[model samples]
Target chain A: MRRLRHYARLLAVQMRTSLTLAVQYRFDFFLEGALALFWLAITLIPLLVVYSRRESVAGWSFPEALVVVGWFSVLKSVLDGGVTPSLNFVVEGVRKGTLDFVLLKPADAQFLVSTARFEPWRILDFLGSIAVLVYAFHRLGHAPRAGDLMVGLALFGVALILLYSLWILVVSVSFRVVKVDNLSYLFISIFDAGRWPIDVFKGALRLIFTVVFPLALMTTYPAQALLGKLTSAHALLAGTGGLAFAAIARFVWKRALRAYTSASS
Target chain B: MIRARKLCKTYRVHRRPPGLLEALRSVVRRRYEEVRALCDVSFDIAPGERVGFLGPNGAGKTTALKILSGLLYPTSGSVTVGDFVPQDRRTEFLHMITLVMGQKQQLLWDLPPAETFAMNRALFDLPRDEADATQKELVDLLEIGPLIGKPTRQLSLGERMKCELVAALLHRPRVLFLDEPTIGLDVSMQARVRDFIRRYNESTGATVLLTSHYMEDVAALCPRVIVIDKGHLVYDGDLRTLARRIRPEKRITMHFSSLPAPGELDRLGNCVARSELQATLAVPAAQVTEAVRAALGRLPISDISVEDPPLEEIMQEFLGGQPANGGVRSA
Candidate 1:
């Protein structure tokens, strides 16, 4: 518990420094917000084109699909904003042996690696996500019950854990592979599949996303909980998957640390 | 206190020739070679002892320091700092030691040095007043009070290094592992860091294990020396003893009033260097008195002095005289 407090303090430092840096380069933050707006605009084009042709997509209404997109946007923002920066830290740390400093510290290495960096400007996307989710709820014309809010939060927490776990598993591969130049690319590409509803994907791809990749649980299930369509069985499965992935991530991290031969050596 | 018993670390590196075809071939048939970074290296250092870890490049000086600092796990044998196993990296062990790598930094690049100090204060769980007091002492010692507020990226190399020292020493660790701590600093800056390190050791009774290519740093700070070459302990004892053993001949530099005849200077000793009205000779330590008498008696010597050879020469002879392909065998 004391170690956890240390991790939190270190993360707070990273967040504060990153925020200060972002404020110094305020134009970058505006540029990122503009880019996000542009992306949202372009993404809405498909929704409009599809909604004009039909009333719903795969038995889901336009606003219902918007919730999925909003959830995905929020998830993407969290991954890109929070987790991706640390991915760069991990790769550079391994390549330059700067990881030695982290390893020598008394804190848990996994916590240190995961929270070593933050890009505060990317929080714009996080805010944008919340805005879109709110707007989508308004469009749906349904007042969400308190139980709905609780389930949405619970599922959202599970989704975040699953995403964090998957990212850790991917980055941990750098320990065995020297040239992880395209590792982040692989992660983003796999995560890209989460942008759309899994029901739109058929057969093998759906199975892969649901079982192997678990991209479906990252955004789709939580959005479903908010939409009042989440089944208890699916929630159980997502929870179990999140726990299993977290366990596997911890195992991989330990194995990778064991395999580490510092750059000087 | 620190102790290591036959501590060894070996790395298996994959080797591939540099070519498109070789790159493709390597994918199918990879080759591996083993490098022994530390081979049966054993040493014991008492508490508060300052030891210079000396060697040529790639001689495993940094490897041994890493092992001692808990950064690298040794392949064999044992290493202990106080009652803690270094590889375990316990909180108490971490609180007791600090490893400062000159080539790398622990300071947050985009943040001010003061921010790193604050972050460390929280991470180390220090009382606020105590942390602040220690920071003030270190900043004043390093004379980096002005540099602490600016972003670390804005500071010059020397300035950043001073702040680096402040960051490392704020915890007041009992054992310090400094690897090339003066690598890229100016001469005066190097001297300042050396002085600061010496002072810190004196004031706190901290054990210091320092590695550097600069012999001056070793001469200035460390009393006893441990020399390793090609991953093996070659000489371990007093620095003066090693220097005397490597080059038993003394250097005799004499300034002549006029250019000496070729035969005249040769008669003094082996001519190491010759110039107009000046010459330097390498005379055996045993014959220094006789050689000095001959030079003073026969030549118009304006000035003459005898001293041990330069440390660079001593190290060169020690490394170059060894077998080319030989691994570090015990001296």
Candidate 2:
């Protein structure tokens, strides 16, 4: 608990610093928020056109698909706004040998890297995404069961942990492949597949998405929880995937650090 | 306290020459080479001791420092810093040490240095009051009162460097690993930084292990130095001993009011250079005083001073210009 509090303080201070920096470029901050709204509209329009042709695709109604889309936006914004910035700090630090400074600090190295940078504007997108998520539920004309709501929130946490573990593995690999700085872009591209429900894919592709990449675990299953379509068995499977990825991240991180011969002057 | 026993760090690096063909080929078939950064490096540093790790670039000075600071795990060997295994990077170990690399700025680039300091204070888990007091003391000592408020990107290199020191020290670390902390600073700024480091070490009793290419940095700050060449420890002892052992000639330079006859000064010492206003002679260490007295009696000299050959020359001789795979002495 003491360790937890220490990290909380550390993250708070870092976010405060990021906030101050964001304020200095207020125009850019608002501009990006506007762009996020624009992106949401642009994304929904194409899907709206597709829904006009078919009553349902992959067993998801248009409004139900909207929930998945809204969840996608929320996760993407959160990762882009908070985690990606900090992930960049880790990658850049390793490439430039600035990670040495981080290692010397009294805090946990992973904690330091993950909390070093925050994008205040990204929070704007997160808020916007949450609004869309609420609107989608409202359009469906059904309130979620209390139990389903609780499970949805729990799965949300698990999804976030799983994705963060994947991110850690990416950055950990970057310590060795210093020249590959665009791994984040690669991650974002892969994440694009998660916008659609895994049910849309078939055969080998569905298995790959659900189990290997786990894009379905990031958004679809949680959205299913709210729609009352989720099962305890599936939730357990997602939770297990999260735990497995968490372990993999830890192992990869240790191995990568051991392999790290910090960049020469 | 710091200790290293036969510390070795080896890296498996991808090798490729610069060319479109090589780049294209590397995409499919890249070659890996084993580069030994440090070989059997060992050293012990007591509390409050300031030691310089001296070598040319790629001589493993940084690799050693990185291992000591726990940023990298050695391929072999062991190191304990403040009684904590550095490679373990336990919170207690990190709390007791700070590494400042001049080439890299840890401060949030777009934010004010004050923010970084505040974050560091929290990360180090200092009480709010104690953190504030430490920040005030360090900012005042570095005389960077105004710079902390401005964005770090706007600050000049020297200003940023001074600010960097404040960020690194908010934790009041007992051990400091400084890698080229004065790199790229002007002569005066370098001197100021060197002075600040000395004072910090004296006041806090922080054990400092520093590496720099600048000879003045070592001469002014570290009385002892460990010289490495191609992953080998060349010399590890008093700075004066290394200098004297590598290059024994003491330089005696005299400034004369008028041109002295050229041959008249040669008898006193071997004339390294002679000019109308000044003349430099390389005299044996045992005969520096005698040479100076002889020059004073022979010519109406305005000023006469005796000093060791500049450290750059000594290193040049010691490393043989390019560091080679060779033997070394340890004390």
Name the best candidate (by lDDT). Answer: 2
Docking class of 2: medium
Clashing pairs in 1: none
* lDDT (Cα, 0-100) at A201 in candidate 2: 91
* Residues forming the 10-long window of minimal summed lDDT in candidate 2 chain B: B322-331
TM per model? 0.94, 0.94
Clashing pairs in 2: none
* Cα lDDT of model 2 by residue, A81-167, tens digit: 888888887887888887877777777677778777788777777888888888888989987789988988898998898889989
Please state the error at residue A205 of candidate 2 in Å: 1.1
Per-residue C-alpha lDDT of model 2 across residues B190-282, encoded as one tens digit per residue: 889999999999998899889876778888899999988788887889999888888788999889888887678878878888767988999
Q: How many pairs of residues collide in model 1?
A: 0
Instruction: Please write out the lDDT profile of model 1 over residues B220-320, one tens digit for every residue.
Output: 89989898888999888888888888888999999999876669888878989888988899999999999999999999899999988877667667777
